[model samples]
Every structure is written in structure tokens, then in C-alpha cells.
Target: MFKRVIWIGGGVVIGVVIAAKAEAYVRANTPKSAREFVLGTDQDHVAERTLSSLWGQFRTIMDSREEELNRRYIDRARSARH
Candidate 1:
């Protein structure tokens, strides 16, 4: 029984030490942006860039569609005028 208790205690201590080391390593290796996020800093630049890129893509698509519609309208108007 004593041997079993010793083994269990040793295992628990080892596990705790390993977990602490891993936590430290992660905190050390984390990027500034991610660390700022963990500290509750306002890191909206990433979100803003993503939203801006998506909006740009959407505007490009809409502009192409608008140009196609305008070309079609102009063709119809010219034909009717003739």
C-alpha cells in the first residue's frame, strides 16, 4: 500500500511540473497579437483587415455585374433607337 501511494504521488507531481512547463513554453512562444488577445486588449486590426478584404471582393463582384447590366441596357437602347 505504501509503494502504491508513493507511485501515485510521484506521478501527480510529475504531471503538475510537466503542465507548468508546457504553459510557460506556450506563453513564451505566443505572438504579440495572440498575447494581447489573451490580455483582453483591443486587437481589432485582424478583424478589420479580414472585413475590408471581404468587402473589397464583394464590391468588385458588384461592379462587374453593374457594368454588364449597363452594357446590356445600352445595347437595347441603341437597338430601339434605330
Candidate 2:
């Protein structure tokens, strides 16, 4: 009787844990915004927005790095010659 009770309790705990994990997984994958819900926006729109933002950031970083390289090399060389 004690062994059976222990087994049942263990099963219940495992079931609860599995259910909680599934809920979390679903929530994490679903979109969170009211606008998205109203607009019926899909995953593709979310991905495109993310990619566009990332591209903008990349361009900003690239421009800054190019300016730094020009200052470090071209400006220094010109100053040395003068």
C-alpha cells in the first residue's frame, strides 16, 4: 500500500511538471502584443521586423567602424607626411 501511494504521488508530480513546461513552451512561442493579435500578424512579419532592426544596427556599426579605420590609418598617414 505504501509503495503504491509513493508511485501515484510520483506520477502526479511528473504530470504537473510536464503540463507546466508545455504551457511555458506555448507561451514563449506565441506573439505577445495586442496589435499583433488584432492585425492577425504571423511569424513571418515578426521575423521580418526583427531582421530589419538587426540590419539597421549592423549598418550603424559598420559605418562607425569605417570612420574609425579611416581616422586611424588615413588621417595618421596624412599627418605623418606633413
For residue 34, give model 2's deviation from the true position in Å: 7.2
Tell me how many residue pairs clash in candidate 1: 0
The prediction achieving the highest TM-score against the true structure is: 2
Poorest stretch of ten by lDDT in candidate 2: 38-47
lDDT of 1 at 24: 64
Q: Tell me the TM-score of model 2.
A: 0.47
Q: In model 2, how large is the Cα lDDT of residue 23?
A: 48
Every candidate's lDDT: 0.77, 0.73
Write down the TM-score of every candidate.
0.46, 0.47
Clash count, predicted structure 2: 0
Clashing pairs in model 1? Answer: none
